[model samples]
Target chain A: METLFSEMQGALVVMPSGRLDTNTAPEAEKMLVDRIKGGMNQVVIDFTKTDYISSAGLRVILKAAKLLKGSSGKIALCNANAQIFEVLELSGFLTLLTHSDNLETALGIVGNPA
Target chain B: MTFRTILNAAFPPFSEARRTKPREMLFSVAEKPGIGTTFTVSLQHTLIVLTMVVYTVIIGKEIGLTDAALRGFVALEIVVMGLTTLLQSLPTRFGSGHLIVHTPSVISMAAFIAVANSFGIGAAAGGILLSGVVVIFFSGLLPRFRSLFPVEVIGILLVLLGLTLVEGGVQRFTGLHEGSFDTPTLLTASVTLGVIIAFSVWSPGRLRVFAVLAGVIAGMIVAYLSGLFGASQMAVVSSEPAFAFPLGNYQIPAPTLIIAAALPQLLIEVISAVDSIGTAVTIDKIDDARWTRPDMQMVGRTITAHGAGLVLNGLTGTPPLGTSSANLGLVAVTGVASRIVGTATGIMLVVLAFLPQVSAFITTIPRPVIGALIVYTAGYLMVVGMELILSRLLNSRRQFMVGLGITVGVSLMVMPELATGVPGHLKPILGSALIMGVVTAAVLNQIFRIGISQTARIELSGYSAAHDAAEFLEDRGAAWGARRDVISRAGITVGEVLEVLHNEHMVEGTVNLQATFDEYRLMLLLDYRGKAFKFAGDQTLDLAAFLEGDEDEDDLALDAAMSQMSGALIQNLADKVSSSSQKERAGLRMEFSH
Candidate 1:
């Protein structure tokens, strides 16, 4: 699987394919912070197609969550499927990241927010 | 001793700072307690950014889109969305403190929207590829300048950006976007807004992370399960193509909106570079870490990111902006200072680029959802602006001039009709946010005597008078005397050493010096550059010295790279010094040859 992350303004947006487990968590976390240092504060984890995220992913999320709390920005989970949501819930990340069924719902929070 | 050893011996000792692992030090924040801690991404920002994206698309579709493209959009929406969210969630900077903050700097979105709007499903991959180039450039440019950017001006800008989107988001909410407001539309908009706000502001602990998110999800689910409106809403169950060819793409579309808007869009590029660099410097200072200059890497990366974005906009049907403050928020919260994380992000961007399936799904975030996130982002911008204002140490006068001017100028220029009489031909030229910044800076500077661009000169030699030259001077060997120099009042003879006894910039310091009265006078110049200047005796004897003592012990290999244009600048200054009695002092005339 491949994971790509980038930032615009001060937000980190990540795109991860395949399973997010212990093995890839470090890689993912590293990529997340690097893109963020230039200007990423808010992050959107698009999990629409993510098959599963293990406790490893949880660890990564927890780490990221804790990091964001210090700054005044936070993370939001978007595009999670049922399996992904279940996994997030089990791992406790669901509580930390704002979740949307799709990108549209996530988009609703801005200006003339729905 | 070998010649090499002699040359190496000439270099200074290691300044402890270089030995410190910037990367590791950056990452260590998360390891601490109460300082570096991460929280779940705020649903507020998630909704905000996502909503803006959807809103842009909804409005854009009204202007230009086909039914076939809409269907393709839905299918694309399903595939890479998880990747998009994951990508969106990674903190750019590692650390803690930013739990609820978010910034709206989506530069890559421009290329995505452009590609989707113009090329349909064909060019999305190409757009992502192009946009990646832009981001890398931004990373490079963010470290050259220091803490010049604070939230004051930025706060106003954010407010304006959010307010500007009001029309678009409201239109989407009313279904005026599609020319019909059904029950589903109102239900979706209202319930979604209320729920999201509740989650963003009132949610607690881990539950709070998903607060705005929970609201949006619940609102959508309610609409779907309740059969609130469109029958197609239930069609999500339909089994569509699970994946699409993200790479090995086909057909580039015509140079449509994507290509047409590159110039105006570049404004985001330049501003974000400045903003990014400013934020980086602030982070450094806040952490009490080693000083790092915002340099070519940051500036270049930022511009290139925007330029590359042309392709992303051309394909993905997303407006683009240079990611800025959000990363800081991420760092504030996460406290993970791993550049490796950024590497992961870069790799993720690459994955997103090739996987059209991925870009497709990320594009599906709803307009209203993104809209709410936009509010969060704007709020963050305001906070950042405040940070900038404070950092700049803006006093009452400086605050009134810079802050008020930027706010008013930005709002006026941003407003469409305020300058309605402006010719269409000049619209692009005059109607610019960056231009607004420059004007505000200039006008306010004049009133407050904060001249960001007033050249200082001696009646003898013309040069940039040292305003913020402390760093440059310190870097050089001139650690003696505090300030650089003062404006010369007397019209003196040639060969007199121009020592700055009292630099009236920020601090006051003396530059001791003397005189040699040849027709070609001996002038001592001290400007911030590669090398430093030193002076000893009264305004009788002073000399320019290479800042050889500031180098690291191992920096012997890199001393050549330390000074940028100082040699040429010194030479130029020396060359500019001419025989005043002979009527050829270029310093006085600046090559005013007749």
Candidate 2:
């Protein structure tokens, strides 16, 4: 239902909350563009408070991640719940997007990818 | 003859013989007398998107990635996807009364890198936003443009787009290159495919929800079991929520650059609306001829709404995507309109919003397995495209052009992107292949038009035949319903008045039941639509006069009826009309029981 993007250090961190369903995926997508245009290459999308992800939502994120790859940028996700994780895995997002245990980890990993 | 006479004649055993006139247009579900199924229709739409997305992903892979190219590409994808969801959701929410299709936009996507790389990232982003604005502004004009771009052409365009994508479909079975395939990948893909097929064929109910999904699941299981994946294989997605608007530093580097990106995006936006509407029209036509469907106008509304969604994409951190052809594939199989599935799908998406780990797992679905899904979808598109040509676009003269044109046109684009020296004039436009295809097709079609008549009667005989059939249905079923709905509404008005009168007290004494019944009968006959045409003509309904006459409150029968017709007295005379038709109105059974 809502996607919030902010520059955390040198990386863009996106925290999503609410339903994030079909009607709200656009908000998530818009957040991605804003960060990219704002010149933040490294991004983190947090799903700690989110509920689910559909094919439409996954596609938007995949597209953004793919774009980031070109800039030598990385996209890391954090705070995903169970159902949300299951949906991502099912739709093949696991291969395209990265995840972290918490906000700090996500920021650390995206900022300094080992 | 008055309306009563006509009603009598229509059901008469004692009257003259006459033919029943036809009703106007009808949708397939509307033609049938039952509650519409949600699952099947949702599947069809899902299939369309699934198929389209599979190929789109392949195309995305093929397009590869470059720093600048990736930015523009990502932005374009985000824009398309974001807008598409909004577009599809709009009509479903606002215009459920009509049929409206929302699908992918291929036009602006191809040009994403071209315009962006040539100008700047800000320019491209601004252009994307501006494009949505244009679509919103001209949303009203889109349906009218349907006359300009016929459904046949739209169908042809899709067929061409599908044929072009078939290469990716083939790559599903065969690996992309020399080292892409192995026993594990093949076995996993086959197992997944088998699961999908068996579930699709044998299992019913919610099993359908995850057949493709299950296939991916099974494939991933097999992949992990075989040591194909490990900790190092994990992918991370952004967790940042979207909070910005479409402006800021993403602002146009220059006003001129934004304007430059506008034209191409507009063309694609329009094309997207047309393509979706055309697909809906075709699918809907197959079932019911009497249904009134949403037109290009609704499509425009949906697209404009989608564009507004794109502004969100700019504000968010995701890439834009348009409607996926996967939905079209869903429509093919289910033939129902269960937007609830779409809603469910949205739910699933929101779920992913909270779980990047889970989404990462989905993305990890083996490439070959993903390839399998693509193969299924693309193959279906080819089949669907052929169905279009064979069913609607086929004919003697135009068949050659429609068929061969689509084949060759799509094939040429698919054959190989010949990176020839970029022409000076085509510099701005040549960046996107979809744009090039549109220009090429238009040019070729125009050239062909010199020798071929632009408006020839025999241009596309099959297409014209289908159109004629649609027209025939509209004249009968749609016309009938319209006529009936009007008269029934009118009848209800007078009926309600009479119903009130039947309960009214008169002269502070006994109710005049006879007077009330007569007034009610007269109102029923005159205020009905079917009754308006009760005279010599089959369609003529003259219902105004009888209903307009004033009834005196002095009538004793009406007063008596009012007294006698208590709640306990005439429960049997309750309204029985379900459909809004004059016939239904006339069938209202106000009976006198023992």
Candidate 3:
């Protein structure tokens, strides 16, 4: 998985392409953690280009959610396909996180003050 | 096994299984359905599916998924299976429109288990999803990869898969989980096998349809009588609800595991797709008088739907689905391959999915009974593999490759110590005998390609057959160094032959094309089980009709004129065109030079 970082409304928007699993999770986790540590606590992961996600990928987002919560930060997931959304729902991540159908909606969630 | 032995042992007769002449079909694809007959036949199909649904339960237990999760997963799996069957049975561009039942595939279980064990269930789920994507891609570029898998390789894989399942089944029978090899369990298995064999051979008409169910019931009776069941097992019947909606829990898979496990999964998917296609082709041969190869468009689409089904399985946390050859065999035995019956079967499954109580009841079947069923299915699988190997001319070279592949696979599978020397990560591939066999067969297949002709073969079906065949020829010809004009000419010639065949009342799904490319020329051999094509010797081109023709000319007239023109064009384009027919197999051989 390769993440292309962009900013909208001062919130970092990360778009991941290809797969988000064990092979790519480490790089993705480090990138997200580094940004959170660097004080860019507001994040949105765009999954439009990413077609696959496994448990290893889920753990990264879970960790990020936990990390951001301690610092009063927010994370929003956007553009998840049916498979990804179902995975998130089954894993109980949907209850713990906020999701939007598109970047515009996601940015609104991430832009709000905690 | 020898070819004769396989034929004799197809389903192993207790009293010489009487050969039922392939039943005459009561309904054709185009025939309208009767409510009573549709319901009756559909019920039979439903029974077969119910027997197969045990796969999901076994797989769920094997993977250590929670009970609730398993139930929900099975619910979704049943629904997907129904929808897939409906898609396949419908007269769609991508479906075979045959009574092909889609269910959780036993062949892929070994790979799924390996992935689950190595990474996690989530990773296995991810791998299943990835496999779906891979299949969709494979559907598009089928010809290029077609050579990689032969009947011999698939045969090895199938036999290995059967052995693996049989091993699992025997372990279950011996109560390895409970660490016992008691008399009760032994009696239960024996009775189940006995009842199924008795019903299959001695039962009359529709009673044969209930053989599997009856056998399981009989085994359960024996288990209960033998005091195998406890109050705890029976108590769940009342506690379970009558109905519940399917709610899938989610677990994202590991990418590394998905990638690592992809090779084995992809191989399994390819075999499943090919097997399903073969089944569809066999049905086509039986259903139509002018049988061509299976419709490639429909076959490809059906495969894509199957892939989509797998993705659904992953999203729902269920095992991957494969086409059930047992159902295909049912279609043959029962002679009711109607789409309406398939639709009814699908609806029945969807209804059953919502009935949690029914699922709860199925769970009560003794482990030994399930083990017996698995063993029976595995026996059929082994025979199916041997039949596939024997389908083609098995030269000594092929015999050696098959022997080597099987020996290597079984050795690795039977003896775990052989894989112990391998590293941890690679164990998924090296550890399992099925994967080992698959890799071996695929590698040897590639290596033994030296003496084989450099040819590409594709099965084309439906109205799109001509177009896809044309495109395939042009694409493959270009890849083999044919000039643009030569490729174009070759494509046109192939299209023309198909058009001529169509004109002769050839149904859309019966054309197979094999093209061999050499330095100087491209030799295309087309086969179909239909009326032989011969160009009309007389050319009656009406210049007056052409001159007087208006834009409002009848479409029928224009079609007739164009059809006639195609024959002449084919003659002009190809240097030599000849056709021959032996028995029911018709061949059109055309040679196009650069």
Query: If scored against the real structure, what TM-score would every candidate get?
Result: 0.42, 0.48, 0.54
* Alpha carbon lDDT at B413, candidate 1: 46
Q: For candidate 1, give the lDDT of residue B351.
A: 45
Top lDDT prediction, candidate number: 3
- The DockQ-based CAPRI class assigned to model 2 is incorrect
- The RMSD of every model to the true structure, in order and in angstroms, is 24.7, 29.7, 31.6
Local distance difference test scores for all models: 0.40, 0.45, 0.68
The positional error of residue B373 in candidate 1, measured at the CA in angstroms, is 3.1
Which candidate number maximizes TM-score? Answer: 3
Off by over 4 Å in 3: A1-114, B1-70, B105-127, B171-181, B229-231, B248-299, B325-341, B422-426, B453-594
lDDT tens readout by residue for model 2, B1-594: 998776433222121112121222111322321233443344333333433333334334444544334333333433344335534543332222222333334544555555545665455556566665665556545555443443335556566556545565546544556766567667766776777676666766445544665666686787788766655566332332223222222222332335655566556555554444544544444334332333443455445555565454344422234545545443333333333445433433333324434433444556656666656656666565555444332233444445455644654565435535664223334533334444444444444434422111111122122223223322322211222222222222223323322223111211111101210121111122221111122211111221122333233532332223222121212232121234423222332110
B1-594, model 3: which lDDT tens digit per residue? 897675333212112111223345556654656787677667656766666677777777787768777777677778888877776676654455567778778667667776677777777777777777777666655534545655567667667767777776786566665566878888898898788778677877556555666776788889999887767676886676788885544243434435666666666666666655555544554466443223444455567667777776666556788887556655644556677787778788888778877756666677788777767767766776776565444455666778888999889877999988986545656676876786787787677656555699999877566567767875665344344456655765676577567655753357889999754568999998876666788544343344245534554654565455555556666888888887777888999764
Worst 10 residues of 2 chain B by lDDT: B511-520
Predictions in order: chain A TM-score: 0.80, 0.87, 0.95
Stretches of model 2 off by over 4 angstroms after superposition: A1-114, B1-87, B90-107, B179-181, B235-257, B278-294, B314-320, B331-336, B347-351, B393-396, B417-419, B422-594
Query: Taking the tens digit of each residue's C-alpha lDDT, what string does model 1 give over B128-234?
Result: 34444554444443333322332344344443443443554565555554566655655666677677567545655334435555656766665555454334432
Count the clashes in each prediction. Answer: 228, 146, 18
